[model samples]
Target: MTDGIESLLPPAVAIILALITRRVLVPLSIGILVGAATLASQESSGPLSVLTGTASRFIQTIDQSVRDWDHLHVLAFTLLLGAMVGVLESSGSMARMISGWTRRVSTRRGGQSLIGFTGLLIFFDDYANTLLVGGTMRTTADRYGISRAKLAYLVDSTAAPVAGLTLVSTWVATELSYLQEGLADAGIEATNMTFSVFLQSLPYRFYPLLALWFVFVIATSGRDFGPMWAEENAAAQKPRSHHKQSPAGSWADIFAAVMPVGICLIVISGVLVTTGLQEPAESEMSRWQYFGHVIGSGNSYLALVAGGGAGLIAAGTLAIALSGVSWELVIMGSAKGMLQMLPAMAVLWLAWALSSLTGEDQLNTGGYLASILNERLPVEWLPTCVFLLAAFIAFATGTSWGTMAILTPLAVALSINLQQSLLASETLLAASDMGLSGGSPSGTAASLAMSPICLATFSSVLAGAIFGDHCSPLSDTTVLSSRACDCNHVLHVRTQMPYALVVGVTCILFGTLPASWGVSPWISLLISAAVLWVIVRMLGKHPQSAST
Candidate 1:
């Protein structure tokens, strides 16, 4: 049966069904069975022999995959991050920071600005962005009579979008390292493409940026979407009550929470810039040597440890001084906070495991799609198509980093191929010119001419992955935002989807279309942002009538 359905059912369908049914183990089993059945059918082997061989092979594959756990550094990083977040929250540092900021904001619009600004500041790290902004701003927004859904929207919108756009951050360092490895595998030089080039390409990341802008426009203009709009309307229709107590904290509390994060950002940025500029040696080292010497030798980890440790120490000191809590109570609170985070951390670990499982086969489904696209679609339409395809994949995976890691290299490869073909055509024309002038055309000129196209395609893929992650319900940041704001999970999803879709569709039409027409990505992005601003303004003025 597995063999029979192999051609009929798509791989994605199998994975999705398995996930929806809460039976991931079943899918892996089915995949193995299918592989064995297919092989046996091809080799004329008996069913029993096929089953035995397949089971053995599956065990071997699983063992080999498990042995590769050395590469799972992100898990360790996340654990440390969890511990740091626990310390900050337990010490009441984050609460004080939020209180101080919100106390200065007199109006709802001003409050929204503070939220957006905080999101931007925390963009250096997505985990920090989500935890800090969401945890801090929730109470502040509530004091301003803002709905939890709106607060969640603000936090979720800013988290991934801001982090994705930042050129000098941990997010970029991790992504760049992965992207560089992938490009190297394809015989491309990562150094040839500068960080400026990537940053310039970010305007095409329509979802997150648009989402951020939409939040500001909606908050200031008093417009809402779906359930959020209904909630606001209901709140406004109710009787007035006495003003709530000030939710703001003291200046001392704010400094304690923010100082460590600020120092970490500065240190990380300085280290990354210095390391990125180092020249490669004349002779290339082995894979292990390169990993150990260049990548692992960096002091960023030390910086993270130091920054987090300092934050814990400062927070503990502040708790004692400001709250006048006994040392025993403070220790007890910290332990409780750590325990509270365990469940969230468990979910994160499961998410990581699922991502790893999905990404186990490096067949480059995105690249395969790009190849089919090259054959079926016109060159001018490639960027737009790639954007949509990447969006769909990221949405399904609910992991932007995973999506970018898989799709960017494929897009880069496709761009190189497309540019080479265009250059060939141009070269043939040059040959005709040479024939008329009695001189031969040069092939080297053609190769140099195609570099721009490769750059454009790479940018498009990055943009698409971010767009999908921005709106994905399965995204961890999205989940954290909802939890932080204390909003209904489904309500948050329904409200944000339309805004994301509007921005995404417009980006596809304006952003990618302009790129296809040979406009510089920077120029195209500016124009796209301008266009988005107009649309957002119109929507803000006459918001759609919807219920929570």
Candidate 2:
């Protein structure tokens, strides 16, 4: 499985089935079962034993994943967040918040921007961003004739990209850790260079940067293409329904909803900083390095749990005190919210199990893909190639973090060695002297600068991971976005793909490719944006106009 193309089977089965059937659970289950069977078949067992092995393998993966404290922490966070939402809804806080938002965001553009900006503001965790944005903004989007698919797109687009790109977020730690580990594994001293390289690589992360810009383009321009336009147009023609007043509505309804979210954000940020500072620091580490180190070492999942609990408590207290609701009502609200999350939790659990099956320990799907890039090629093409490879792996595995973990070390080592090998060759050295080194500095200065190939490939992994996560139906963030927006999972995937592809291709063409050839990333980004603007104006349609 590790060495063969058969490693790609499980995810292929799952993704193909999901597309054909337009369903999630059945396809995911079948894919997992198939993967389990493949693993089981490798053992010397009788038919009966092999059958039992398949079942036992499935059970073990789920059990092991659930037993992990990190997984439990995430689940707990989701549960608590759900409880907070329930309290808000049951207490009429949701309706009040919606009403307030509706008045301020009179048009579809404002409503969409509000959702996008809120997502950007919550740049700490993708899970929190997706859940908070999708759940809170769905109703307001509905009022503005925005479809569930559109809401899901906005939420999904902003969630991972923001978390991945932001200076301080749950993703920052994992990303830095992976990059550091990759550098260390490549025999590079990472003490000072890891954070520095990461900072340099940020500009090369064209997908996330473009994706964020594309979101606002979609938001402010009020134009859409493909299935999203159809969804939006249909939604526009449908009469807007008035929200029902809660029997327990009060003057503090808006306060009740907004306060809990604010408290959650504040508590999470406070915990992140505090916990980060608590980690062991090196005297030699600079202020920025120490900051990155602190964040990279902090217990982010714990912070999520603490923040969720605090928000839940605030919501319950607000329901009881401000809304003057009964303790029973508060309890029910909490229970109700938690219950609503059960389906998504189940999806997450299955996703984790499936991810485990495809992980380095199991099928080694990522490893197989990594092995294919062993052949040498032009240095400038590495970023584009790496981006595509990372995208495919993430799409198959449905986890951006997993894809990064698998590819980062390999990409770093490969790029460094390739560059060294090329520099050693007389023919290549002559070309490098002739300015074929992609605008790299000459002589000793070139040695001091970060390798353009390394930086671009590094950023490509992050960018591609996000790209695949956005389009993949099996992705947890995608699932969370669908769940939060209350959109059909398959529908969300289907509608969002066109918009994702448009930005994805544009960035690859105008951002990564040119930038790799020594074009400044800022210039590439500007060209990409201008191209995207042309695309939207030429290809996109107004929902209201299209409906008429």
lDDT of 2 by residue, 66-126 (tens): 7866667767887887788777767876554444554566678888888898778667567
Candidate 2 TM-score, true structure as reference: 0.63
Regions of candidate 1 where Cα sits further than 4 Å from its true position: 1-83, 124-143, 167-174, 189-200, 223-230, 240-248, 276-372, 394-409, 417-466, 469-476, 542-548
Please report how far candidate 2 places residue 78 from its true position, in Å: 14
Q: C-alpha displacement of 311 in model 2, angstroms? A: 13
TM-score of predicted model 1?
0.69
Checking candidate 1 for backbone clashes, the offending pairs are 99-248, 99-249, 227-548
Candidates' C-alpha lDDT: 0.56, 0.75
| Poorest lDDT segment (10 consecutive residues) of candidate 2 | 440-449
Give per-model TM-scores: 0.69, 0.63
Per-residue lDDT of model 1, residues 1-548, tens digit only: 22132322223443454445433344434543444344445455787887777666455544443343322333333334445455566677666666566667665566667888888776555666777788777756655556667677778778877877775343554454344333432344534343434443455555556667766766666665556667655554444234454466767677666664565556555554456446463377886555443433344433444444454455566667765656776676556545654543333333222222222133233334434554576667777777787777667766565555445544554554454445555677777787853333343322422344545565566667667766778776678778877788877777777777877887777667776677775676667667767765665532223211
- The per-residue C-alpha lDDT of model 1 at residue 352 equals 28
